[model samples]
Target: MQKKTDFYFTYPPNLQELDLATMVSMYRDRGEPRKAAPGKYLACAVTHKLLKEAKWWFGLYYSQAAWDELLTKGSEGYPLTEAELNLLGLVLSSETPPHREYVEKNIGTLPKLAYLIVNDIKQFGFLQEDEHGYLRITPRGERALQGISRRIYQKRFTAEMLVVYHESEELHRDDDQRNDQATLF
Candidate 1:
């Protein structure tokens, strides 16, 4: 007779606190276990454990008011530029497509505001352009506002925005330094 082997696995006690939904979302968001069928996503033990730890830091730093201020207002106590706030609010508040002329008149020229709105739409997956070329808020964007009230989604979005801003600033500084060195040479 041949002997049979069985595999066993154990999870850390701390991971028990992360509920199934959060785990599923974390896994899906990370795009792990590639090509997993719907309702069949399985996170590896290491990924599951790390998500458990990450949840703590999510709540530790991000607050609803802070993110709201960052979104509606700009960071560091500076109010969002009139164009920035207006453009964001217009799309978020209305499903109807406002005319391009109206947007340009009220929100300033497209060139002036396009970079901010375009970058936000790309990075956050919160806005989409309609077939008619009108912009609209996506389901994810609606979730962001809803989450703002609950404070969960708000934190994640705000953290992501901060990271992007910091990276852009660092890149700009590096470019400046390179230019200075070129001038010196």
Candidate 2:
């Protein structure tokens, strides 16, 4: 007679518990992307968030006339003293001619302008102070100015927000599709 062999099954004591934990872990991990492109995602997120906040500020008060005057008449690359910006902001904010006249009177006086600049416009990042205690527009400031100008002139600021969000979504989708296709092979 031919010899017969019998097989016996064995299981780990915690097999069920281990399997459950592994599955839960896998499901949780699968929700997040294994590899996300650097900078692009972060840039998109920040741009979207900031643009939304910026829209409100742009609408509420952006001194177009003052901005135009500064850009066109003021000296480029030369530091615009904090005093100068304070006077400009004051003049722009004034609704009545009398108020504007009063603010304009302080334009030439350094002390008045000094106090106004220290209290108000100095906090903005676009204007940076140099060792000489003078403030100038940074490259970031220039870009911000241009963006605000465009938004004001074009009347498409809200639409631009949607465009940015959609473009980022499309880029992310494309990356996912590419990843999926690569895995298929």
Best by TM-score: 1
lDDT scores for all predictions?
0.39, 0.35
Evaluated against the true structure, the overall lDDT of model 2 is 0.35
Best by lDDT: 1
For model 2, what is the error of residue 142's alpha carbon versus the real structure, in angstroms, after optimal superposition?
Answer: 1.4
Task: Please give each candidate's TM-score.
Answer: 0.29, 0.22
Give candidate 1 regions above 4 Å deviation: 1-84, 99-101, 108-111, 143-185
TM-score, cand. 1: 0.29
For residue 59, give model 2's deviation from the true position in Å.
Answer: 14
